[model samples]
Target: MPSKKEIEEVLKLDAEKRFSYTIKRIADFEFVWAIGDQHGFANYGDDNGNVAFAIWPFEAYAALCCKADFANCKPEAIELDFFQEEYLTDFKDRKMRLAIFPLPTDKGILIDIEEFEQRLQKELDEYY
Candidate 1:
């Protein structure tokens, strides 16, 4: 799991090119995560109920790169289906569900940045 500081650094590096897409751990699953954007404020789950990992500028760019498969990734041309139905589904038999809202945003995990980071870190630590 990436630490808050690490995430912050990554976000900082990606600042100029804001990564509006978000990837979050699926609720009720141990190793399921999803990738999506913040549109319509759709609720993937209860606010602050599930743990969201990262919000990247490129779709599945972080997940693929984190898996050390950077050579095969083309973020600019990546699609959600490329990740959801193909890659992420292998982790679990069901579909990959992603929340529509960004972290620390209203209607989903209403909290400050520090608290959000702390909660994510805590959940990750406990999971490991």
Candidate 2:
């Protein structure tokens, strides 16, 4: 695992580009996830992992939560009201409907890169 400082540095770089980061705890581990607009697509992933591009912010957030332990995640839902109608319409037209509805956001939800890294470091300390 990367040190907290390294993770924070990576997240900072992403944030400098206006991307948001999320930290999720799995079975007994935590992973950093990020989403932001870059090169015409909304990218999502960690420093050295698979990335899902060309997706919406909410979509990326939802996908990350799905792979994590929901009980330990934040408590925010992704209501349609959170997004603009035009964006939804465009996504629908492109056949990229959201698989998870009412995305969650709270303590363990997708947060800023700094927060994500901080929380991740805390979780890692507890785990180890």
lDDT of 1 by residue, 61-108 (tens): 244432232233322323434544554344234322332333332222
- Candidate 2: clashing pairs of residues: 74-108, 76-104, 76-105, 77-103, 78-102, 78-103
Q: Which portions of model 2 miss their true places by more than 4 Å?
A: 1-24, 30-110
- Cand. 2 TM to true fold: 0.25
lDDT scores for all predictions?
0.35, 0.34
Q: Provide the lowest-lDDT 10-residue window in model 2.
A: 98-107
Candidate 2 residue-wise lDDT, 1-128, digit = tens: 44557444533443223232322222133222323322232333334443322221333343444434343333222332333244445554553422211222322222333343354456456666
TM-score of each: 0.22, 0.25
Q: What lDDT does model 1 reach?
A: 0.35
- Give the TM-score (vs. native) of candidate 1: 0.22
